[model samples]
Target: MSVPALEARGLVKQFGALLATDDVSFTIQAGARQALIGPNGAGKTTLINLLTGVVEPTEGQVLLQDHNVTALSSSQRVRLGLSRTFQINQLFPHLTPAESLGLAISERNGSGADFWRVAGTRPAIVAEIEELLTRFGLEGEMDQPTRKLPYGKQRLLEIALALATRPRVLLLDEPAAGVPEEERQDILAALSALPADVAILLIEHDMDLVFTFATRISVLVAGRLLTEGEPEEIAADERVRAVYLGEDAG
Candidate 1:
């Protein structure tokens, strides 16, 4: 069988006396849409950190495709086709989306050191930036300072920046956390349009978005793997309802 796009085996993390992650194991198959949902403090962030090398695992292994990247740095992981968005938007306040994306793409192509000098003149980088802006629906505001764009657009741009790396596996942490209801559809539409060949692991609290985007869902509680199943199966699982989903899980 082909190796999964991303895999975590026997993952564990300890901070002082607390166990942040406990024997966690999961796989994100190529092109799969997976959601990881849990209540606050469920160690969701810790798990993402472990996968991306934001912190080392106390005991476990992280694999990208078939390669063992357990000891790789965060930058190393990104170069290996693993990319992620944080719960908080990490945008350069003063730079326009075009500049940010140009820098990211240039870096990925080993021309980042001169991105500023070539941003306006490089045909290839400019083309890719324009393409990504169009893909993320930021064409109208592509040249505006990132801080001046609407919060939802800023969020979308952040995702676009991640995509600039052309990752095989994408990890999204609460992509809609602060997006207003009126603007959330834009985020949804953008996510729905992503290439099917890229595996996605979304960590979010919005159940509606979760059901609409994920074919499969994993529930986490108290730093452990609670259960995982299809969208319907998870919605009907009483254990999930009691702990995280609550009475209106569906």
Candidate 2:
């Protein structure tokens, strides 16, 4: 059997008496399209934290391509081909989209300290930044500071930044959140166009995006894995309907 791109095994996290994640475990194969959905306070954020090494799990392990990475810091994990976006935008407000991508790519190449001074000197870096911005549909806005761009564009730039690291597994934490309805299609398009070799684990609440993008879905309830199945199975599940639509599970 082939190893998964990402795995969380028997994970648990506790902050004092509050158990944030309880024995949660799952895997995403290379190029898999998966979504993690749950009601509010279902421990989704905490689980992402554990997976990305933002917080340590009290118990259990995180494995990337079958290597134990539970002890790695977040940056180490990023270097090991694991990267993530955020629920809210995480971008440099004053940096243009081109500058940001250049910096991220330069950092990944270990030359960020002097990237700004000699950004135009590197043909490879310039070509990559152009490719990424063009891929994300930000070519027109490349020269504007991130804060000057629309919320949706800012979000797209953040995703592009995460991709700059060339991760094998990408965790998207609410990529569509706060995006206006009209701009959402752009986000969806960029996501659908991601490199097929990269496994994406989307954590989102937009049913439209979730159901449309994910082939497999995992539902969480109160910090535990409620169930995981194909989109059809998840949609037809009574417990899932109850959690989302306020129907009675009993």
Model 2 weakest 10-residue run by lDDT: 241-250
Would you list the C-alpha lDDT of every candidate in the order shown? Answer: 0.93, 0.92
List model 1 lDDT by residue over 58-105, tens digit each: 999999997999999999999889999989998999999998998889
| Cα distance off (Å), candidate 1, residue 211 | 0.3
Candidate 2, 29-57: lDDT as tens digits: 99999999999999999999999999999
Poorly placed runs, candidate 1 (over 4 Å) = 114-117, 247-250
Estimate the TM-score for candidate 1: 0.96
CA deviation > 4 Å runs, candidate 2: 113-117, 245-250
Model 1: colliding residue pairs? none
